[model samples]
Target: MLTLAISLLVAGAVSGILAGLFGIGGGAILVPVLVQALAIMEIDESIRMHLAIATSLGIVVPTSIRSFLAHRKHGAVDMALLKSWAFVLPLGAIFASAVAAVISGASLKWIFTGIATVVGIKMLLNRPGWIVASDLPAQPARSAYGLLIGFFSTLMGVGGGIMNNTFMMLHNQPIKRAVATSSGVGVLISIPAVIGLIVAGWQRPELPPLSLGYVNMMAVALIMPISILAAPVGARIAHAAPKRALEISFGIFLLVVAAQFGWTLLN
Candidate 1:
């Protein structure tokens, strides 16, 4: 019990720092770390990925809320767009969770590995193609981007930040607003994604201790406070930083993480 608490504490601290340092919710860093930690706790490898992914979402829910509120304080969120798209993201979350459950762990690892590889290559290459920036007041259709974000968010376990930011950037939204709005959208994506994971894994046998369906309650308990508290700090940083540097750094970070995922799969 003491060890478990310590693990959670460390996870929370790491996650919080990452969230503050980057505009990301920290799951990109948390998922792999949590999976390994669960393994250390004697969790079955077969189900570790699912548990890790689900638990990460569970933790992310509160953190994303915190982040959204923080950004809202900064007047960064596009409430109109968020309200319009809220209805469809949950459907996407459900679909993604269901799809993830059907995939075998080994296969899922490879898929993650592939994504990581792409992230890494993109980062290493330092791609400089910037999306056109505009805020024409036209929101994307609810069903289209919402569903796509949900699918990729759940499937990749990264919350929909990358895709959402890309879409916003392409449509000519200001980068700061894009990141902030995406953070808001993430809360929407995570709520249903966590619930869906719980529903999908409710009957899953061999789950580790203190699990709530696929989501691990303990992980949520441990990570939520730190992530939430630190998010505002991240928002402040995002407000001050050069958008292009943040994007490039995020890309490189993705590459490193992706290589790690691939290596984990092979070994």
Candidate 2:
């Protein structure tokens, strides 16, 4: 138990920094970190991923809120767009959590692996030409994009920043505004996803100790506060440093994580 606690503490610290550094939220890293730590506890394979995912979502709530608030002060968050998605985002996230309840853990890992690899490759390339459209689409199409981001963000235990940021930038949004508004998206999607995960995995026999459904509250307790503190540290570093090198480094890290999950799935 001491070892598990120690590992999660370190994960919390690092994940917070990663969230600020990448503006992609910590769940991208936290999920895998939790999976490895839980393995040390001999947690059953069937529920390990679900627990990790849920716990990460729990942690995401505070970090995303903090990020959103900080960014909103800059007057960069797209209020009109955010207001429009009031119902749409949570619906997508809840639907994803519901689906996760019925899917195999391995299936979740596969989805994570594939998406991580693609995102990693994109980061590594740092290409200026991967964008699809010039301007934001019409109403229904915009809603569709928002829905997909919320759905996949929950499925991957992320804060919706990764997909939403990229999507906005591709559609000719300014970089600062894209990042700022993505943080708001994170705030909107992650809260309901946490609740949905709890309901989805309620009373499951395979849950580990200290768990409430899929969420291990103990892990959330250990990881959340410290991570919240460390995010500003990462954001400071990002502001002071060369983003290209940082992007490449994080890109490599994501690929490595994807490889680890791949190996786990194969065995």
Candidate 3:
């Protein structure tokens, strides 16, 4: 217990920094770390990923809000767009929770690994020319995009930031603004995702101590405060930093993580 707490503390600090730096909710760092930690705790492999994912979302609630406010003060967030997404994003997260209640843990792992691979590759490519659409489309269409963001993000245990960043950047949104906007997306997904996950995993057997469904409250308690505190530092750095190096670094990290997951799947 002591060792797990310490590990979670370190991960919280790192995740806080990354969240602020990259406009993420720190799920990229937290999810894998939690999975490994849970392994040490001898959690059942069948629900370990689900538990990690749910806990990550629970921890994200405050960090996402903190990051969003940090970016907002810089005037980088697209508020109008976030307002448009407000209703649908949570709806999607809720829907994903329902879906998760039925999916196998290994299936969830594959989905997360696949997404990490694509996102990692995209980051490494760093192509400014990869525009999928000329602009963010009108509503209903926009709502469709929000649904996807919430859906996949919830399933994968990420803040919707990554997908939001990719989608916006593809639509010609500037990287900084995209990052800021994605932070807001993070806020939208966090609470609902946590709730949905909890409901999905309610009364499951074999969860670790202090678990509320798939979400581990102990991990949340340990990770959240530090992550929240460190987020502002990251947000401050993000507005001024050269992103190419950061992108490459994060890309490599994701790909490495993906490779690990792939190996697990194969074995």
Candidate 4:
């Protein structure tokens, strides 16, 4: 028990730091790591992926709070934009959750694997250069963008950081504000996604220990606070780091994680 606690603590801390630095859910890092680590601990495979994704999301809630607060303190967020897009965020989550229920576990794996690979490849190519500032659309269009972001995010367990940030940056929203706003999206997306997981997995066959539906409460308990505590440190680093270097390095990080996930799926 002590060993498990310590392992989760380390994972949470690393995830939280990355979450803060990137203004994204650390799931891209946490999910694969937790999945493998949990397996090493002899966690059953029946619900392995579910636990990994759910616990990663659970950890993200607290981690995001810490990062969001830190970013808020810096006046990095665009509160007005958040207000405008907030409605679409939850709606998208609901849609995604509904979609998840219909898909089989095997199908979900393929979906996740595909998304991870595509997004990773996109990050590597550095394609989709900055969206034209002058082309920044009206309010309705921005809301549409939010809905799209939320949809993809709910399916993948990410906090919609890449989508939202990319959209905002294209429209001339400063990078700081874009990152800050993306943090807000995490809360919105997680609530519905978590609820959906519960609904989908309730009473299903074979779940591991300390699970709430698909979520592993033990993992959540162990990971949340550590992530929260480490986020401030990451936020400070993000604030100080050169933007281009940070983007490239993190892009590489995403690539590595994607490869890891693919390998897991294959093996």
What local lDDT does model 3 show for residue 9?
A: 95
Best by TM-score: 3
Clashing pairs in 1: 116-258, 120-255, 133-172, 134-172, 134-173
Q: Which stretches of candidate 3 lie over 4 Å from their true place?
A: 1-3
CA lDDT, every prediction? 0.73, 0.83, 0.90, 0.74
For candidate 4, the 10 contiguous residues with the lowest summed lDDT are: 122-131
**lDDT for model 1:** 0.73
TM-score, candidate number 3? 0.97
Worst 10-residue lDDT window for candidate 3 reads 14-23
lDDT of 4 by residue, 1-267 (tens): 577667677878877887778788777777767777777877667566666776677777777777888989988888887788779988887787777666654455566667666656655554345557655577787788888887877677667776777777777776767777778878777777788777766776677767787777877887887788888888888788745666677677766766666676678
**Per-residue alpha-carbon lDDT of model 1 for 41-154, expressed as tens digits?**
898888888888888888777777777777778887778777877787778988988987788676666666676666556445533355454343345554687788787777
Clashing pairs in 3: 20-234
Please give each candidate's TM-score. Answer: 0.86, 0.93, 0.97, 0.87
- Residue 265, candidate 4: C-alpha displacement in angstroms: 4.0
Residue 175, candidate 1: how far off, in angstroms? Answer: 1.4
Instruction: Tell me how candidate 3 scores on lDDT.
Output: 0.90
Over 4 Å off, model 2:
1-4, 237-241
TM-score result, candidate 2: 0.93
Model 2: lDDT of residue 221 = 88
